[model samples]
Target: MTDLLLPLAFLANGLAAGVLVGTVLGVVPFYMTLAADSYVRAHAFAVGRYDPFQPACLLVTFAADVAVAVTAPTTAVRVLCAAAGLAAVSVVAISLTRNVPMNRWIRAQDPDTLPAGWDMDAFRRRWARWNSRRTAVAVLALVLNAAAAVALP
Candidate 1:
């Protein structure tokens, strides 16, 4: 069980971290630079692309981490996996509470008919900040998973 789960955890964590860093580096800065109307379109497009995919990857990481934590032979490996799971949970919680709502709001907006007094600047800033937080946690989860793999028998 440990043998199977450790690799699965690593794979999911890697996928989650890759996408998070990609957004943290690529689409986020570009979207932030766009005007409000343009941002709505681009942000909605990006959000649609992610949809269930990113969330699934993060969930896989958490599930695998939990399995590894229970099944790993040594205390060190188990502890590492548990820590990794904690980080994975943090990433999921942040996405649910912060990023997902902002993404949904952007998807619902009509670029041409945005409500008056919409605050794109603050919205983008808050979204990016939450993204950065989750990205950092996902990356840390990857590192902790790696350490667990190394500590395994």
Candidate 2:
């Protein structure tokens, strides 16, 4: 069990980290961006008022991050994963501070309570900047985890 411990932990950590980053980049951001885009396209009139997909995806991402951190092979790997998670949290912070405010403004101004002059340029620029930072950190975490995996067994 001791022999198996390191490798198994590494594998689980790798898998969980991969899932966490993948979902953040592939699933949650994709849907949220799409929903935001759609809302803007309809002149700030979102039919659903809120997107159910974003919360679900966020939940999965949080769970995956937790799993990876818990199963990491070493203290170093756990710290790296935690740092990567912090990068993602920064993205969320940017969203809440900048993007969300923009969204709220859009909602309030477009088509009566809201105005319909939203151009995707500014939003895309901000989103991409934050997302790229997050991606870089996530990639670093994965690379570090991979190294740990190779070293374990």
Candidate 3:
């Protein structure tokens, strides 16, 4: 069980990291290049489609980590898996509290036209800042999960 779970955890973490890093490095930059209306429309479309995967990856990472921690043969591997789980939980929390709301707010707007008094620059800045934080947390979680996998027997 532990052996199976360790690889599963590693795969989940790797997938999560790939998605997060890709958004931070690729999607955000591409959005930044677009005009405000285009940004809103493109993000609304992309985020609407993309949001589900974030939670799914986090769920897999957490479940696999928990399994690994419980079934690990040694104290060190258990501790590492627990730490990786904590990191994954943090990513979920941050995403739900910050990123999801922001995305929702963006999605709620008229993508073709700005709302009265809406500050596009401010919105972009806040979204970018929150995304950077999410990316960093996810990267940390991925690294910890990888380390935990390597630590396993």
Error of 2 at 140 (Å): 6.5
**lDDT tens per residue, model 2, 1-153:** 323433443344344445445645654455355544454545344312322333233334334445555676667655654554444445345545754565566555433332355555566566446545544544554455455445443
lDDT of 1 by residue, 1-153 (tens): 999988988998898899999999998989878988899999998888875788888888899889888878899999999999999989999999999998998898889999998888999899999999999999999999999988887
Q: Per-residue lDDT for 44 in model 1?
A: 91
Which pairs of residues clash in candidate 1, taking residues 3 or more apart in a chain or in different chains?
A: none
Q: Each candidate's TM vs. the true structure?
A: 0.97, 0.44, 0.94
lDDT of each: 0.90, 0.47, 0.83
- By lDDT, the best candidate is 1
Residue 110 of candidate 3: its Cα lDDT?
Answer: 88
**Residue ranges of candidate 1 with Cα displaced over 4 Å:** none
- lDDT by residue for model 3 (14-119), tens: 7887888888888988988888889888889989766888778888988988888888898888988888888888888888898899899888888767788888
Candidate 3, overall lDDT? 0.83
